[model samples]
Target: MKDMFCFQCEQTAKGTGCEVKGVCGKTAPTAGLQDKLVGATIGLARAVQKTKATEATDVCIKKALFTTVTNVNFDNESLTKMIACVEKKKAELDPSAENYDMAKLWEDNEDIRSLKTLILLGIKGVAAYAHHAEVLGFRDPVVDAFFYKALVAIGSADAGMNDLLPLVLETGTVNLACMGLLDKANTETYGTPVPTEVPLTIEKGPFIIITGHDLRDLHLLLEQTKGKGINIYTHGEMLPAHAYPGLKKYPQLKGNFGTAWQNQQKEFADVPAPILYTTNCIMPVKDSYADRVFTTDVVQYPSMVHIGDEKDFTPVIEKALALGGYKEDKEMTGINGGKKLLTGFGHGTVLGVADKVIEAVKAGDIKHFFLVAGCDGAKPGRNYYTEFVEKTPKDTIVLTLACGKFRFNDLDLGTIGGLPRLMDMGQCNDAYSAIQVAVALADAFKCGVNELPLSMVLSWYEQKAVCILLTLLSLGIKNILLGPSLPAFISPNVLNVLVENYNIGPISTPEADMAKLLS
Candidate 1:
């Protein structure tokens, strides 16, 4: 038997192929099955676009896409079942079209291979946002149709860069819509986020540490833990929950725990509380904390307690009680000396005061807007983000999110125009919030998002960040500064295409990049 078979997306095999099996935990059979699922989904997307779209079709597309995300699914049985579901949906939507063979795309020419990779990867990213929106009961036609269009492009060899390039961007544009849908769903469900300070310390007694990007799960946990004498701490992307009015109102919803996803092994090793992972970025668990880790939603780990359909968190609660936390009230601080950090500056809060922001800009009080956000990693170069935010000119406002905020989330940048210079807009998924704020600002200034005197300097460590970047590109937002390291997966040709069309580049030193962006 072959040792491996990879080539799922751009991050697969250096734009050529993957070595030592799948880097994302996929084996030869599993990888082959995923490609089959992707081909079937493309066929389904193509079939559905020809007619009216329905909720069922959208849900099917989303689930299939999510199943293929790195580290999400590894079961061949589940993947094969998903592929069958795609076939059923394709048949239900368009009973007459010939089934498109996915093998054609994989076997196409290398140049065509590069272009289709962009579209496929872009849509994979789009599927993530769509999945999030679907969870919140939101869906859009344009976004749904493009999933088919992108897949159809992958199936057709006639298409080239000229065709796939625009399609890749369309993924970003649709992501904007998908994000808007999610933003609406979240803010509407939980109430608008506002400026609130959350502590980093765990308290005495029982508590739950919730990570991942899903607020619905976090909300449910907060509801279940109510009056149970258990405290809840936000970990990873959930750190921004402190800003939500509904969540913050819970007295036991307590503070934050741990740092970024990469550090979870060391951070949670000795913790006295159970940790819940609602989505991706779950590292391989250590035996020390293995018993205390739990997974809900799409996050799965072997032997860990998984809170399923009942959504009942009693097991997690009991684990917290057994751990019983510290014997006394504990104190904690962020990377800086600050004991508290501020968040909840989502689009609603920012846009509600759009006129004031415009006035501030016109009055020359807020000189620039800097979006220094993305996923944080274990690498050393990441400290540059903390330094970058720290050195931002006093007149500039820095908006941040995802796990990267852990680097400097504790740093107090003071305030500008009665607003903190450093604003945390929730998790990586909340890139939707940052985009909304930018779009609102652009609307107020009567200019495009690019012309709004704002800069996006980001760090990415996983697929979620990849999708967000595609969404940014889809929106035609340019001059993004990306760093820590380039994806070991993106081929040179694909990188060239992004650089030429979108002005995307690796981040240099904060000083040099800042001067260039400001200039």
Candidate 2:
């Protein structure tokens, strides 16, 4: 029998499933445990369907699913504990409930499996956002309710394309609400983001590097590390934390330390200070810096120190002080050799400048808006994003978010009408910002969003991207260009549906795709 089977990410082995192990560095055993974790959560959903879901069940379900997300948790011990938690919660909800065997879905017919996988993976992404929102005391009943509904549909023995297709779109529609919930949680908690420039230089002293997407964790760390002589630098998805008024208030919340998530192994190998991971996109730990890596929230790795729910960052702070950071200020640059990265152009910031942007467009100073956004991976051809942004006409605006912006975020793309040519719109969770900007721009132009001279060229690596794509498609957005590869879990039939319905197409060369998008 195959050791494991996973195709949830864009870089699945050979453009098919990974049977021997996961391309994301998960062992066969870890993969099996993750599948079991998901199975137990499904089982819990089944119980919740029969009985009512309490806040405990809701929290357990979200944590279980979030733990299984790519690069989040690799420890079998933690996975086993999570499974027990799910099972225990299931038992509390309904004593007779049983766990669904994930193997059955894996071996099912391809098309049905594809549709269910879409719902399943899409919810996994939703769970992540919900977890983040819930952390900030923000919860949406609609988003919580959809999780149970989708999970039940996945476990249904007689589920078919007819039964699952609409749910798949509903997954997207619900995800839009979930994203909105997260957006509200973030903005209300931290205040609306404003445009800010983040430096890449690392100041000398005891410091901590925080990666991942959790703003609350960053806020807490920034609070605890205050006046402690420990400077904190954001990494990967945490780079956008600099844009928040709440986070940027801390003087010691120093500059960003690295680029996208995929480069962690090389970028972090010898870094002096401790690195705190608050969410996914963590790679397999290297012996070189493993001792310095600490994780909190759903992010965990074998033998890595995890800051538990109490959220005390004492260990991370101690480690940073112990490491004694750089002896002198260290200079860093992004992929394009630029010294600083600019971010914080969320919906609030973008919309605040709507009149100026509208005038620029009407005056022909801004020709088009290209959203070169989504997750970035280690895969080749990602440079296409950098090249595409480089090739865009001077009058066009390039909006980017998530780690994919690392491909060109450092490039000095001159401004149009006093606004930078390229605007960094926070993290992947901030796709809501892009959508809001699009809809508002469409409203300003008195046109449909699809007719607003905007194009989305997305680079996806994981499930979050999947749900966001579903959200975009659910809104009837069309002609999206996605690459470096389409998802392997999407069967030809489902892909055909997307192609016909949404005009979604795989990306080609930057030159050709840019010409086509412009044309």
User: What is the clash count of model 2?
Assistant: 0
1-519 in candidate 2: lDDT tens per residue? Answer: 999999999989999989998999999999999999888888899999999999998898888888888999999998998898889889988989888899999999999999999999999999999999999999998889889999989999988888999999999999999999999999999999988999999999899999999999999999999889999999998998898899899999989998999999999998999999999979999998999999988988999998999999999999999899999999999987999989999999999999999999999999999999999998788988889999999989999998899989999989998999999998998999999999999888889999999999999999899899999989999999999998899899999999999999999999999899899
What does candidate 1's lDDT look like per residue over 1-519, in tens digits? 444545543344554467467655567787777778887887786787687667787788777877676666655766777788879878987877455665566556666775676567667767777777777677787788777777777877578767876776676677777777777777888888898878777778998899877888888998998888999998878888888887888899888886777778888888898998887657667888988988876666556676776789999999999989988877877766678878888777878877778888999999999999987776568889988888899999999888898899888788877878888888777898888788788887789998988999998765567768888887778889998766644567888877898899998898998889889
- Model 2 ranges off by over 4 Å: none
Name the regions of candidate 1 deviating beyond 4 angstroms. Answer: 1-18, 21-33, 46-54, 74-108, 487-494
How many clashes (backbone N, Cα, C below 3 Å) per candidate?
4, 0
Candidate 2 yields a Cα-based lDDT of 0.93
For all predicted structures, in order, the TM-scores are 0.88, 0.99
| Residue pairs clashing, model 2 | none
TM-score of 2: 0.99
Candidate 2 lDDT for residue 32: 95
Q: Whose TM-score is greatest here?
A: 2
